[model samples]
Target chain A: MNFAQPVYYPKADYIETDTGNKVSRRATIAGPQNIILGGKTIISSTAIIRGDLRRTGPGHAVVISLGKYCLISEGCILRPPYKTYRGNFNYYPMKIGDHVHIGANTVVEAAMIGNYVEIGKNCIIGKFTMIKDCAKIADNTVIPPNTVVPALVLFSGSPGQFVENLPESTQELFESQTKQYYNRFQPLEG
Target chain B: MAPIKDRFTIHSKAVVCQDVDLRGEITIGSGTVVHPKATIFAITGPIVIGANCIIEEAVIIINRKKEVMRIGDENLFEIGCRVECPSIGDFNTISTRARVHYTLRLTSYCVIGAGCLVVLPEEEVLEEHTVIYGPASERRVWSGRGHIQELDLRRKHSEYLRETLPKFNRLRRGDGA
Candidate 1:
């Protein structure tokens, strides 16, 4: 891993919120009011968070709730899953736990992603899929709709079957890696 | 190089986000919901999209040929999909990160699966209800009857977005009716 290399971005391209969430200017974040971001999350350029697809009718609703120290990489699209209930179509909120690292160009439509999960590049997480804690989804994996990925396993391939069990220390490893990635993502000094 | 003319005709009921990148001549029919960061580049032709289409974020539709590129109603272009096809019929779903090359013509009820790349020979046409999916880019004919439920769901999705998106994001006006 290129963990030691510090990735520098232009300071003008990002807006750093008070909660230490770094959101890129080029990222298309629709309905910022409906998105709840925990502290120290990094939303890279070209990442699209569709918070506007909230639940229909009456009162306000939270569309996407992301936890702390998450890394949404470049070109990643995060859209909440939607389905028809009682003959009326509605969108459900997406919940993502802490220390989750979503790789570049991955389109995630999952209902929930648990803590310390690492999803690799170019993966398509289908609608309403549930990924539990400490799971590792390999690059280019296409998970089918309504699939449940249990904890501590590595999922790969087009249909995204379980490949093998992950190490017990995966949670610690992912937490440290995500924290390190957030720290190393800095702007070049003048 | 000559400056390209910007001519867009969007219906008043269409909800196009302000951040969408549109160039050259384009016509968007009513009830189309174009999300932010979607790009429609008509470099050498006029592109016409029919009613109730959902153009999701980061979708790039480029028309480089001299002939007009037309797209029918109730089509769903999901996030990060690229389409350079000549013409497309109704009720098509192009899933996330799929690429349809310029030489193909797509018909109604065709489902292009996620991450699939359709790069057929020149002037090739995709038949109706053709489902292209999997890592090997498998092709199959869907034996089910007309996708009435799916199309109805798509229409509902588009309607919901049209009603909800403008409430949260800035709309691009003055280019459409």
Candidate 2:
């Protein structure tokens, strides 16, 4: 319930797409055609979305598919996971569900992140990590590679372990928070 | 803002994305892959990155000291990591969100784990096979014997990036040989 104040950004800095995606002009999005943003997504300044890292030997695969009301804060890097399988290197596609909020300076190399997930500032979601719905990761947490986080849990600390079960109301709270954040992000008044 | 003088000498075989902000004099060796949004700022001196290095997205390599910064071959700078060190030897891996302060000089086969900060009081050179990790910045020396597998993996990874990245992303045009 942080109804404190609305944050205003310079209108010149962001490009509001047809689907209401407010992407900063400074954000470097590689391979825009391979990324699908559902809508109302805010990609702040210096955030990099690596959609060019698609699967090899593929016929036009989608690299990063993000759902509605997602927020990629400043200095965040979102790159798809890759691995050597059967003596061949391959990059996997990353999927993020709705109302997901990734904080500032976070580097996410996850395979999948489910709905209503809130990842805190400076966190590193490791390679091929899968996060279930309504999961929350605290600031400076480093989730290990191939770790699977269960639903409705709070993950904290380096080599992030499940600290506690989140309240059942987490989904509703996260949804509202994301929606409010999107609404409150307005252009500076003249 | 004043215009930045771009003095970059990228090898023809290297894959440096067009979106990378390369300022001052920098030399990228053959088989190196510099991903988009990676920043290489040589403020005080030149930076020479060796062959088969992988500089992932948002990685920042800054040379703020007077001496030249020389990074050796087969290095991997993972996403969002910051390197301000003056010298880094071959086969080092600086993982995600890690910070290598200007005071530390890394020798060959060092691994700075994710989110770790290497900030010594003054200039210190780390020995080979040093692995600095965790929130507490614990230090350990990995046995160099029987560890050829990691370097092999890195070589394969960089080779894959050098081949596939140009097919998807627009590469920065190399000035000269």
Candidate 2 per-residue lDDT over residues B5-108, each given as its tens digit? 66889998889998788888899998999988789999878899999999988789999887889999999999879999899999999998899899999999
lDDT of 1 by residue, A41-114 (tens): 99999898999889987898999999999999998999999888887989999999999999999999999999
For candidate 1, give the lDDT: 0.92
Off by over 4 Å in 1: A1-5, B174-177
State the displacement of the C-alpha of residue A169, model 2, in Å, after optimal TM-score superposition.
1.3
Clashing pairs in 2: none
Residue B172 in candidate 2, Cα distance off native in Å: 2.4
For candidate 1, give the lDDT of residue A145: 88
